[model samples]
Target: MPILMLIEYFRATMQQWSFQKRNVAAEAKRTLTPWAETIIQANKNACNNWMVYPISNSRFVVKSFTHKSVVVDFQQRTCTCSRWQIDGLPCGHVIKVLTMSRYKDCSEFDFKAYFIETLRKNYEESVNPLPSPLESKIPGDLMIVKPPMMEMRQPGRPRNIDRILSQGERPIWQECSTCGKFRQTRSDCTSRGSRSGISQATVHIQR
Candidate 1:
């Protein structure tokens, strides 16, 4: 009976894998058409000057006018909107800046700069490692008492860690707008906040 069950499980797993592969292939074929220009136009239509805020020491915040609920960080190069992170392209507000400035071919639009290598290299030469300058020697006359090790207690509550952030994960770096420093994400920026903020431009999309 056990042998029969094992054989049936194997057959079922193979069928599921085959079905999944076919579905993925079909989806790929459907999405292969050129759609960048269409998406650019759509973004232009919905573009608005969102409020930019410094979310943290290194992050900026932006709020949506139409939706009235989204926050964005220009430093982190992230928006509360789901589309930008998923697509690896600038969001509508970002595209608005590109179009307005007439800088479609600028460095800001280069998607590769957002990755680990180029960003790290931008600041690499500035960071130098040095050993501690102070030297200290243990005093021979000082007596130190060793405490007994207590029984190991089970950890209480687990720390709330962002699962997506792991030690093994490399940073996606971006160039700092203020200091010209390259950093791992915009959050590593060293520039102080500016009182002058970017204005929102109104864009109309064509049908």
Candidate 2:
């Protein structure tokens, strides 16, 4: 019953957007986070600033204005910084090497996993509407089961009475019981005297 309601809700929502352009890739590209776009743009700009020196057919060394260098291998799709290998996106150094190699579509160095087409295909499947419960034939012997009992939680901060911490799981710092300052116990606390004493000292200093 809940699944049927969810399907119906999804169908109704999809109907509202059915008239809009249905390009999944375009939609996915539009939804890229600002930080992601910034990184891509920064990489592009960095590619322009870096100088590419060819080492072999597929290998090169990219050097920045500051003499900071990184080795780039187009064949392995890797950079010395490891960013390209880990993220599957070409780093600025790799981009500069690709540009020097005369590759027109340096952006293609980015993994297809980040492509809009891949994203679109993931969400392309449509949920079908389920038949009305009244029209469906259920067995006469099968009884309608009641929902499981759920205790209403009391409105307050829950206690961790059931929590069992291991011997290894100790707090990062010991705190004083008297002053509540961390990294020391109550015995080590210097401010154990009355607050009035500290207040009087402050007033005296001010005067």
Candidate 3:
């Protein structure tokens, strides 16, 4: 299903590219990807939810409605929330701080990864359609491989007793009736007790 989706995406991308006269980078810039535009819009909306307090020309503290505050350092390009550092895109706190500092464009601070040129380069490669199985050629020198043998199950309802025993309906170890111990039978436990008694008798004789 994932492979089919990828094939469909490649087909659609190639179909769209066929209509474009200009290069992929130019075409990509003309129309921004949905995800890039979405992030931009989200950051813009989030600016209203934040309150910016200027610490210096490059440092700021942005407080949200929930009383959550994060420090934004423009010079370092980092936010205490760590989103800006990880994603390479200015998060809500950074955006709010930048806006408070009278920075007109927030996109200048966005990472190169989100740039249209980067996106264009990623999709620039052509994916050719595969040849039909009928047209596919196999080397004559290669050995022919046969399908694996199928093992047929016995034609009866499987015994539930074995399944139950395997699943712990019956205990694997037998308890010794003589010593109340597991794994050994009553006769084996009696023999062990006799050996211990003999050892104790020998020690007493030596003493």
Candidate 4:
């Protein structure tokens, strides 16, 4: 499914699950468990560090939350810890300090957006083409010896519809007479129930 469709499905599910309560405070009080709050606080704390400071207009200096020994550059927004690069989110050390200082509401800009922009810029810089002379030089020696390309195999065996039609498909479910629920059909059920003199209307599944 498309991302937009998936997002809509999630929104619909959330709306269905939301309780029909009038007061927002009442809803929060009912839903907010102590354990949930602790987890939220822990996640917030993970994104902070003392070394984490906005160094200049575009740069920030930080240290790794996972590895205290490894310092980092938040301006370039990178860390020795791969988590920063993999997820492109502010690491634990940055998050912890940001929560502590309450820098989220600051007038300059949102730190989250700044952090994302830093990673985006880094990705853009990596994809930018090199100068023409250097680009041609790197591929020249490698492309000289042409390796023989292997032939790719086609997909699986073709269907034999005639053979399939010869073997009839089995019925999966039988409708229950007593209740509407589906039950496995037994060949001897009619005889067995008649011998026992049980009311067919009240008959229950053997299983």
Candidate 5:
């Protein structure tokens, strides 16, 4: 029942998300919102304090007044500062270069992942509702599982322990009295017909 509830909850969430995406996509005229444009413009205006050196028609080097420099590549849509490739948005360095190259719209330099068409296509598919699994006809070849098996082990601390030791601590090795071997307890000793230790223990108990 919990599994069914989980599947139903996810289905409902997907439906809701699809609806929201469709609405936002329909209202979107451009990739960047007005707020994003405002931020980009603010950065573009601040670029006046930076120096731009054009390396080629597609690449340029930008340096801030603070002596920090970064490379901007238009063909690759990447900046050395990495904001252009990471966030799919142009960094201030790229904006500075675009202005020098006489590009009027800075938003056009954004990656296709941030495009309005991509946003519209992402939510085009509708999420369908699921029927009850118990009511549905299941295939005969489907593998079924059972939980009738019993746990045969005791519920308590075990004697044979295998774990890491603490710092500067030596390992504790066990020696069996019957087998006279390391790491084997007397109960699991494999020395055949070794009853001398048991006879002496019985005699001590009787005395």
Candidate 6:
């Protein structure tokens, strides 16, 4: 079967497994006892490093120990540091604002795009297993693709793909063959008085 067709065939299977992994993780993060302890520690650390001044139920200003100020808005789900909008997780400043809010109706999401119920509902559609590749058959009208032609084998030991060159190093000829010096090739070698190598290859080398 074609590579693309293979991917499409297992697309549902892939999504099903991926959802399972994320679901497990989200549940773990939400319920982890150690994480709660960590949060309590983080809150204490936050107090030492930052000062939050409430502007409204949903807005606040957080000032760091270094005097760097960032705005936090719970209503818009945004922070000046951009973690809330970009990472889809509340930033430290926004978390502080939430802790101070007194309104019972000033609600916030469990998380920005990854609530437990949302993940379950999104992957709720019934997914059936695809037939084994050996058991599957291609349509007769579908054009059968031939194997790709083998590349011509290069002579000499293959260059190690993992080899990293140092600064100013490359695979190409770095020294002039005639004079065995750097920064100049045989085509423009001015120190040819010392040696007469690369005479044959000079014709092939560009001027």
The candidate scoring highest on lDDT is: 5
Each candidate structure's TM-score, on Cα atoms with residue i matched to residue i, is 0.28, 0.50, 0.60, 0.25, 0.66, 0.50
What is the C-alpha lDDT profile of model 2 across 33-75, one tens digit per residue?
3344567678878668778788898888888987578888878
Candidate lDDT (C-alpha), each = 0.51, 0.66, 0.68, 0.45, 0.75, 0.60
Q: Candidate 6 lDDT, tens digit per residue, 72-185? A: 876887889886666554556766666555322221433534454455455566455666777889788998889999999999986563455667665553577777876566
User: What tens digits encode model 4's per-residue C-alpha lDDT throughout 19-121?
Assistant: 2221222334422333333544565665544456565554455555455544445466665665556544545554544554566522122234333233333
Which of the two, 2 or 5, has more lDDT? 5
Model 4 TM-score on a 0 to 1 scale: 0.25
Off by over 4 Å in 3: 1-32, 132-135, 155-157, 160-207
Candidate 1 worst ten-residue window by lDDT: 198-207
Runs of candidate 2 with Cα error greater than 4 angstroms are 1-21, 24-42, 65-68, 115-120, 136-207
> What digit string (tens of lDDT, one per residue) describes model 5 on residues 1-207?
798899899999999999988888889787665446666777777788888998888889999987578999888888898877777777889888877778888768776666667777888998989987877997899888888889788889654434555576665566667767766567655575544343221111110
Instruction: Supply candidate 1's per-residue lDDT for 83.
Output: 64
- Best-to-worst ranking by lDDT: 5, 3, 2, 6, 1, 4
What global local distance difference test value does model 1 have? 0.51
- What is the clash tally of candidate 1? 4
Per-residue lDDT of 1-207 in model 3, one digit per residue for the tens? 588678777877876674352254555553345476687678779779678788888898888887578898988888999988887777888877777778776777878777776776676665566655468796889988899999999999754422323342444466667777665566556556654432211011110
Q: Candidate 1 residues 1-207, lDDT tens each?
A: 587567667766766665654444444432221244356557767775555445465344445666655554556676677566776666775565455546554235425544334433443332223333245465799988899889887789644333355555544445556566554223343345432344222222222
Stretches > 4 Å off in candidate 1: 1-34, 48-60, 97-207
- Candidate 6 residue pairs in clash (backbone atoms < 3 Å): none
Please give the RMSD to the true structure for each candidate, in Å. 33.2, 15.8, 12.3, 23.7, 7.0, 11.0
